[model samples]
Target: MASPALPGREPGAGPRVEDLVQEVKRLRAEVEQLRVESAQLQRAVASHAVVDQAIGVLVMTAKINPEDGFMVLREISQHTNTKLSLIAEQIIKHAQDAALPETILAELHAALARRR
Candidate 1:
C-alpha cells in the first residue's frame, strides 16, 4: 500500500522524503566537522597562552631575553621528546609551585648562562 502524502505536501511535489533525510544527514556531518575544528582551535589558543606565560617566566626567572627564552623552550621540548605546549604547561605549573625539578632548574640556569 502507498503511504499517504504529508499535509501541505503533494505526492510528487517538491523534494522527496528521502532527499530531505539525506540533506539532514549531510548537514549533521558538516556540523560535526565544525565541532571538531572548533575544539582544535580552542586547544591551539590555550596552548599558545601557556607557551606565552612560560616564555614570560623564563625571561623573569632565567633572566634570558624573550628570543632566547623561546629557544630554551624549543630545545627542552626537543630533548625531552615532549610537545612544546606540554613542556610550557609543565614549566608554568612548576613555576607556580616555586619548586621546579632540579634537572629542569639546572637546565634553565645553564641556558641562561650560555646566553650571557
Candidate 2:
C-alpha cells in the first residue's frame, strides 16, 4: 500500500516525502558543518592571539620580527624535539611574568642550537 501524505506537505512541493526528509537531513548536516567551522575559527583566533603575544614577547625582549620569532620558536621545537605549543606557552608566560631568567634563555638558545 502507498504511504499516506504527511501533514503540511503539498503533493507538488518539489519533492516526495523521502526526498523532503533527505533534504531536511542534508540541511541539518550543513548547519552542523557550519557550526564546526565556526568553532574551528574561534579556536584559530584564540591560538593566533596566544602565538601573537608570544611573538611580541620575542620581538620586544629578543629583538626579532614576528616572522623570525615564529621561526626561532619552531627551530627550538625541532632542535629539542618539544612541541611548539609548550614553547609558545613558555614565551607567553615569560612575557606575563617579566622574570624569565637570562640563564634559562641562554640555555634555551643553546639547546635550540643543539650545543647541549
Best by TM-score, which number? Answer: 1
Error of 1 at 8 (Å): 5.7
Residues 6-116, model 2: lDDT tens digits: 688764555666988999999999999999999999988887787777778777877767787787777766766666766777778877875545644664576435521
Alpha carbon lDDT of each predicted model: 0.84, 0.72
Clashing pairs in 1: none
- Could you give candidate 1's per-residue lDDT for residues 1-86 as a string of tens digits? 77788789887678887999999999999999999999999999999999999999888987888899899988777766779898
CA shift of 109, model 1, Å: 3.4
Name model 2 segments beyond 4 Å from true. Answer: 1-14, 80-83, 98-107, 111-116
Model 2 local distance difference test score: 0.72
lDDT for 5 in candidate 2 is 61
